[model samples]
Target: LQQLRSLGQPPRPVTSTACVPRRSKEVPLCPMEQPGETQDAAALPGPTRWPLLGSLLEILWKGGLKKQHDTLAEYHRKYGKIFRMKLGSFDSVHLGSPCLLEALYRTESAHPQRLEIKPWKAYRDYR
Candidate 1:
C-alpha cells in the first residue's frame, strides 16, 4: 500500500536504557531516616525492566514457567526477599519471607477469595 511505502524502514540499531526512569524529585530513591523504619516499595531492589515488555524477556531467557521457582530463588539471593518485577505493564512484588506473608495474611479479609476466578467460571458456564 501507499501508506506502508510512505512509512520508511525501521532504524538499523535501536537504543535502550538499563531500566525504567524513576521521575521523583521530592522523594529519595531509598529513604531510611529512622531506625527499624521500612523502605518504600520503589526503594526495594529489582532486576532491570525494559519498556513495554518489561522483565518478561529476561524471565523467559532464564527459562519459562518450569524454572520459575529457580529463577525467583536466584533473584531472591541477589535482590533479597522483597523485589519488584514488571511483566508487560503489570507490576508485581515477590515476597519470599514469612514475615511479609504474615503481614499480607493479616491484612486480608476473614474469608479470603481467589482474585482470579473469572476464567474458571466462564469455562464452567461454557461447559
Candidate 2:
C-alpha cells in the first residue's frame, strides 16, 4: 500500500543544534508574566518540593522500599496517573498509569538489570 511505502521510507534525523534568531539582551522574555491568570500557583502542585531536599525529603520521610511504593500508588490515586515523586536524594521518578505499570511488570521491563545482583534487594528477587 502507499501508506506502507511512506512508513518504510527513512525519516529525517533531528539536528541537535539549530540557528536561532538573536534577540536584544536588554528585553527579558518573561513568558510567565501574563495578565488575568486563572490558575492557582500553590494548588498547581507537584510532589511536595521542599527548600533544601525538594521532594527527596518527602520520599525519605515516608520511609523507603515498600513505603515508597505505597506512597507512589497513593499519589497516583490522588493526582491521577503519571505523577512525579522523588526516590532518595538523586532520583525523581515519573510513574506512569496503572495500566503502564502492569504492562511493564508483565513484559519484565521494570529494572530488568537489577536481577544480576548477588543478593537482590526487591521481592522480585525470588524469580
Candidate 3:
C-alpha cells in the first residue's frame, strides 16, 4: 500500500470505473459516469397526488381496500403500462406490462436474501 503512494500512482477512486486491471486506463460505464440516472417520478403516469395522502383518497373513492383490485384495474386502464401511486405511506410504482415484469423478475437475484417465509415463494412458484 505504501509502495503505491511512493511510486506516484494513487489507487483508483472507485473499483467500478473500468473493466481494465491495475495500471490500465479506466473505462467508465454509462451508469457510473452519470450517477443521477434515476427515473423521474414526475414523468410517470397516475392520478393527481396530494402531498400528505398522495393518491390514497382516489383509492378510497374507487372502493377502498376491499375493492383495491378493481381500483387498480381501473388505474391500469386509465394510465397505460406503468403508474406511480401512494397508498397511505407506501410510495410505489405499479408495472402493468409483461415486459416490465419480466425485466424486474430477471433482476431478482441481484440482491438475493434468505426466504424465512416459505409460503411467499411457494405461492409464486405454484403459479
lDDT of 3 at 7: 31
- Tens-digit lDDT track of model 2 for 1-127: 0111122323222222121114321111112323212232233335776656667666667885559777676777776544444334533334344433432233333234332435554547777
Question: Best candidate per TM-score, number?
Answer: 1
Instruction: Quote each prediction's TM-score.
Output: 0.55, 0.37, 0.54
| The 10-residue segment with the lowest total lDDT in model 2 | 24-33
Q: Write the per-residue lDDT of candidate 3 for residues 1-127, one digit (tens) a residue.
A: 0111133332334333233345534322121233213345456788878888998888888888889889888888998767778766666777776544443343334343432548767998899
C-alpha RMSD by candidate, in order: 17.7, 16.2, 12.4
Model 2's lDDT to the true fold? 0.41
Using lDDT as the measure, the top candidate is: 1
Native-to-model Cα distance after best TM-score fit, residue 51 in candidate 2, in Å:
4.4
Cα-based lDDT at residue 25, candidate 3:
42
Model 1 over residues 1-127: C-alpha lDDT tens digits? Answer: 0211122332122122222124421221122332123455565678888999878888888988678788889999998777888879977777776544543443344455544759778999999
Report the Cα lDDT for candidate 1.
0.58
The predicted structure with the larger lDDT, 1 or 3, is 1
- Candidate 3 yields a Cα-based lDDT of 0.57
What shift in Å separates residue 107 of candidate 1 from its native position after superposition?
4.4
The lDDT of each candidate is: 0.58, 0.41, 0.57
- TM-score for candidate 1: 0.55
Worst 10 residues of 1 by lDDT: 11-20
